[model samples]
Target: MRELLITWGDGGGELAGRLVRELRAAVREGRLVAGERLPASRVLAAQLGVSRGVVVEAYEQLAAEGYLVGRQGSGTRVAAGVADGGARPPARVVETEPRYDLKPGTPDLGMFPRAAWAGAVRRALQGAENRDLGYRDPAGLPQLRRELAAYLGRVRAVVAEPERVMAINGVGQGLALLVQVLARRGRPRIAVEDPGSPGTLALLRAHGVRPIGVPVDEEGLRVGELAASGAQAVLVTPAHQYPTGVVLSARRRTELAAWARAGGLVVEDDYDAEFRYDREPLGAVQGLAPERTVYLGSLSKTLAPGLRLGWAVLPGRLAEDFRQAKQYADLGTGAIDQLAFAALLESGGYDRHLRTVRPRYRARRDALAEALRTHLPQARLQGVAAGLHLYADLPADTDEQAVADAAARRGVRVATVGPGRLAPGGPALALGCAGLPEQRLREAAALLGEAVREAGGTVREAGGAVRDVGGLGGAVS
Candidate 1:
């Protein structure tokens, strides 16, 4: 048998401990098979230039750990029933990369301000106190909280104070924490916008909260339906509704505020409210009823989602409980990242970054709208005034999934509105316009038009003449 190989670095544990670890690894990795006899203590000790006592100690330890078996006449052998760590599980099937990706819930990752972020990180680290690096308040860094409170108040008209801000991983984590708090408070049911974010619905269900779906229309979430659902709490994306991109009208905002004033809880998800093209985005619903609303915001849309940095502006009543939940959920977010973001906000770098990317995104959105109008004049587009994506309502008879699949085959990917819908609705597609360039977006829209036509949708000419297309079969050019 080959001599046992052991790495004994300086200050690595005792020689016997090292030998025991090596042998146990060998057995677990299947390098040493079951019933394989190890070299005698004396022989191994001589080969490894260690004392025989050290080898004996290691062997005894391995035997105690059930990694080895010793017999009176036979030498120590690898034990049976040991799992092989080297064995691999079946490989996961990977999907092909689409030529044009138009899925929602993602921004242009290429627009991340790497240089400015790196600078902020460096400055934060250099200026940080020793205590700042240690265990921090579960609520978040004080400086970051202050910056977030000020920034939100200024940008989104959110009524916030530093004390009420809780640093969180993202809106997803914030929602989870809110669900936990609500369940404890005996309010276990929450109303969400119908055809809202399916991810949010699944997340609430995962946390044991029953989500009641309320209908949404051109005016936004139907407050009348929400009231009828008998849910005391409701989650809304008011500044810009998801998938549909409709801004809540002034009348609905007043009604929602009235609902909150009458003792309903409002959980406002202020996602992607900073990218309105025609005018400035509206103030948050939380600003109207600060004491009754829990406002959540994240950098996932503005910055890269990979940062996982976000904040929650809570009502005074739920602040402590949410902070405790955050504490227990990974001892709060990373301090370095919090400090870096705070510095960026303080230095006005974040606003500048937004200013730079806003027009670029708007250009992409325009290109997509124009492309859809040019290629598929029959499709009606909505939610184009704000947000990173647009909702294209197809003909009622069009098969949404079939169109999505046909588009995929043509190397153009889109998100179907089916999964996001809780109630039966018209067929539509949510196409993201933030990830690709203007020209690529035009190409994707042209391909999507072809897919729709192939999936039995009517194609209308610019002069409004309808032409019927055949079923899906021929390949897209």
Candidate 2:
């Protein structure tokens, strides 16, 4: 009862009144609990540097208001019901601890190379100079940009020079910065893949830029549709598309390059390019059209998302504008994290880690396919060649959301493929298999089967070698 938090407001009002208001607010805000004994008046008065009479007056007022009760020799206690304040309105959505989480694009966090990362960070600190500790080039730490340029060029065959590369917090920050740059340059409408990363579309719209949807097929973005979309700029995931897991085909790549050459700008999101299971992943589209494409890649998928590290390799002309935007974004990303990432890249530690983790994800992908085949034979799976998840098409009549909700109840979580600004096809499911143990993957698939049947829909396999279903509707402008 000796410790009480009381802030003495401006001496505009009586000290006792200010104390009473603050105490009531503390209880209402749950900072003070019911039935908890408060400090003696003299004790609180001394702590708050106020007079004992003021404390007594505050306590007396609060007691009259039923906010305090003085028990025999028990000192002053908060009233049992005073702390509740009032009943709160129901929340719009109540999040529960999920039994089985299958959210898309989520990596196996447990597999993060903590030892290597810590070692890299330690080395970075040991090597950092005093000047490196100060505010640096808004583009990024010079060492990191140089390392990134070389790493990207050797691995993805990108035409990146250190001078044109900018380190960002993550791909999201890079996108925001690029959007600002483009909007200033009179390009506000960007065509995105239909059913793309809805977060990307939302980011654009939130910043007053319009995102037009261009449908993507088995090969990837329909360049013809993009050209006709009347958008001056476009964003794409060429190595591996999101939700649907298709690579941009070579012919369409040529068309996209040509379109970019004809005064259009392309922003490439090279996320999850490290996890391709089939073969050496395709080179970045920026390599084919370096003059017009800006390539964005991040460590969120490979390393822990908490690192918040990524980079953008821009066309030389666009690099300066991006640097200015980056400067204004946060002054710059942290120097410690940047130098640490540079150490990781220069020491060949990053390559060694990729070698260790790639096979693990590949095995998980295989397990997902097997589980789906055994349990939900009626469902068609696509996008299994790479990335962390698969796109599943259930029987035509199934209610996607109902099935997902039912699966959630069965201790398995699944997500319905969002329609985004365009409906790619029938209601689709995006199921992530990474991080889940083999047994859980099988169990999740079984749960999906049960959920579908429970939704009053029959499970019949699609009648075809593969289900490259046609568009459910036209492109969304």
Candidate 3:
């Protein structure tokens, strides 16, 4: 243990964190055998001349991260499988694997704030009380609820109060819970924005709630259509419609809110509103109709999705029922995770992270737009100023499947919007730019352009005057 700590670093304030990292690396590298007993916190601390709290904290963090297991009298041991020592094989890059991944549903993983997140976790563990460690309220940790409510109010103009907020695993779970509650409340059809997230539509159906798809145009979801569909409850991505990228217009917002004010339920998925680049993002529709809106948001967009953290702001009438539903769902999400997220939010660490990441995402978005302009000039790109994915409208007669298949053969994956949603509008592709940098985005554009032509569509040329559209001649380092 002393040797391991020595190899990690000279002990100080970061001793616990460094120890956790060091032990994790040892387990991953096969230096630590699985099921091997670890030194007790006191013994290890004495041996290393550090406080026992350091070792205890290290053990706790490792346990939380699933790297180590601790038992009362059994002591701690390295976890199985992920780090079995000597049995783990080396990693190698697969040549046939796609060179770049620009598919939607993932964020720029490279920009994750490792140090800040670790610090937040450390602080949360140190500050958490004994009661906080137990199976507590299903509404989520009060600390997290308080912080998240404040953060949402200040950042999104959301009408959130701690008592009415419920922390969820992510938007998926949030929607599931909402659907269940609504289904029990006699809402059989859950209206959703057409050209919206198909995954969400599937989620609604899987939860036994029929989905009513309403058409969305340039200004956003058609409120007229929504009202005509006869759905008392609707799930919408109003900030930026999935696959369409249009913000809800002022008229539409007023109309939707008025509908909700008249007792219609609104479930707002404010996806990617934090990453907007054009103008200030519109306030959430939930804010427009708090009494009827159930606002759903998650860190999946602004933060790493792997964190699996999100929250729902429920109306006063449904808040208690939603909390009870969450309690029955999974006995509530992990409290430690909630506390850590709260710590990050209270310290403004989350905001700082967004500030740093937003610009990078914008640059990637710009690169994709530039590539599209130069290579696939016949395709007009819309919704480029917000969200990680942009909607590329191909010629009215272009074959979407051919463009999609051709791009797939070349190593890029363009989103293929299926039937029911693409009606009336020409064939379009939701090109995701978040996962790739400038050069890869440009290359992806060039590949898609070739696919479009092969699929019986014409490509426009800029007379060869611009060598690289969007200054993407070479990949930005």
Local accuracy of candidate 2 as per-residue lDDT tens digits, 1-477: 436565675757878898999998877766677888889889888888888999899999999998889988999988887666454435689657567777666688998889988999999999999888899999999999999999999999999889999989888899889989987888667888987775676677888877788998888999999999898999898888877888999999999999999989999989888888889998999998898999998888888778888899999889999999999989999999899989999999999999988888888878888888888888888764788878887877776766776787788777666544354357677777786888888888888788887984633345312221111111111
Q: What is the lDDT of residue 87 in candidate 3?
A: 53
- Candidate 3 per-residue C-alpha lDDT over 366-415 given as tens digits, one digit per residue, 9 for 90 to 100: 99898899999988877638888888888877767667777778887766
Over 4 Å off, model 1: 1-26, 29-31, 40-76, 84-86, 89-96, 457-477
TM-score of each: 0.86, 0.79, 0.76
Ranking, lDDT, top scorer first: 1, 2, 3
RMSD to the native, candidate 3?
A: 11.0
Query: Between the candidate structures 1 and 2, which one is better when assessed by TM-score?
Result: 1
Backbone clash count for every predicted candidate, in the order shown: 0, 0, 0
Write down the RMSD of all candidates, one decimal each.
Answer: 7.1, 8.7, 11.0
Which regions of candidate 3 fall more than 4 Å away from where they truly are? 1-97, 419-425, 457-477
Q: TM-score of the candidate numbered 3?
A: 0.76
Point to the candidate with the largest lDDT.
1
* Model 2: colliding residue pairs: none
